[model samples]
Target: MLKIVYPICCGIDVHKNFVVATIATTDRENITTYRTKRFSTFTKDLRALALWLSNNQCVHICIESTGKYWIPIHNILEPSCQITLAHPKYVKAIRGKKTDKKDSIWIADLHKHGLVPGSFIPPADIREIRDLLRYRSKLVSFASSEKNRVQNSLTVSNIMLSSVVSDTFGKSALAILSHLLKHPDDQDFDFRPLLHGSMLKKQNDIALAIDGTINDIQAVKITLCLSHMDDIKRSYVARGTAF
Candidate 1:
């Protein structure tokens, strides 16, 4: 015989705009009663749902993971309810007969017998850190892609800066590139002033590498790529500070 783990519990079917909730109350005689309600996904409606659950003395709640739709509901109910966040497969309803109310009821039935397993959710602080780190990672990836675009622009324009310097964006290379962009028509400008440290020894090679022509369009593309890379770097630093 199945054991009645929670004498009274609620199950929720989360959606983007709304949710359906059903409360299951089981009696000692093995009888179960259900009361289902629909609520909007807005904060006010979710608060009312929490209040309704509190009033019915139902603290154990089960809900299926449905994209980001379940996040707001979980946030609103986290303070007052013992929420069981189950994978959708664990609480799936019968095919061809699935309705919001029916799904909620099915979840409630599974939860009532302690048949539902909750997914592992880190604490609030850890979740916040995780989100920030993930966003920073994306920023780093964007910056790398922008750097690649800049390198491609240089390569197509016959700018062999990458071949002469270990880092094309290094101080000396950028100084030479900046001068080239500012004085696009003056190819004979001396490279000695831009050459620094060990780069001074490779002055001849560096000058030869940058001797190629860079059209107006290629120059503009390189400029835009550098600008975007700078923006991504700033965002990455800001996100790290937020962490």
Candidate 2:
């Protein structure tokens, strides 16, 4: 019972490999005409689809957002048409007799009658910023995970480094750790060279902290953890310099 608002419009069901497009046009007598076509999702084919729509005088386009498959199509057709990016949940047809062709037809019918609601599509610059933030968040999470792994390796080896130093990865702490990992069996080791300024005041406490038992296995694991931490640190610095 809905009135036809767009006399000429297109609906596209997007997929990874291909897309099914349905163009609906209404005549002066209110009789509707539908032309269905299949096109590959490649760049040239998308251009062909856009050209076909333009030839049919299709101005308004309704395309269901199916994963990221709809992006390329939208980008290609955006300049020439008024695009309505419909959310799949709202545009999805009922289950029983569904096909990609039928889905395209259903979307066209809904859009032609002004029954489809468009989803919010952010501008390109905002989308780029959002993607950058997401990537940065992922990198930060990975760096935190590597830090936890380093702490876990120290804890399992019964090393009190974390308890003694506020930042175990600090210069003084890493120096002491490197010395201990190098001469883990040398009980008569001196902590003087590794101690500096404020840390030198806590020389006795640091000596006690480094006195914890560390087997060959723990030494190897800690060495690998420190190496991985260094890699993460360098990566973080590089990313910072990029922005």
Worst 10 residues of 2 by lDDT: 234-243
Instruction: Give the whole-model CA lDDT for all candidates, comma-separated.
Output: 0.91, 0.86
lDDT of 1 by residue, 100-143 (tens): 99999999999999999899888999999899788878878888
RMSD of each: 1.6, 2.5
Report the lDDT tens digits of candidate 2 across residue range 1-243.
568999999889999999999999988777888999999999999999999998999989999999889999988998899999999887889788899899999899989989889998888788878888888788678767777876787787677878878898888998877887888877668878877668878877877777676788877877887787677678778877553
CA shift at 128, candidate 2, in angstroms? Answer: 1.6
How well does candidate 2 match the true structure, expressed as C-alpha RMSD?
2.5
Candidate 1: residue 200 Cα off by (Å): 1.7
Best by TM-score: 1
Give lDDT: candidate 2, residue 71: 93
Clashing pairs in 2: none
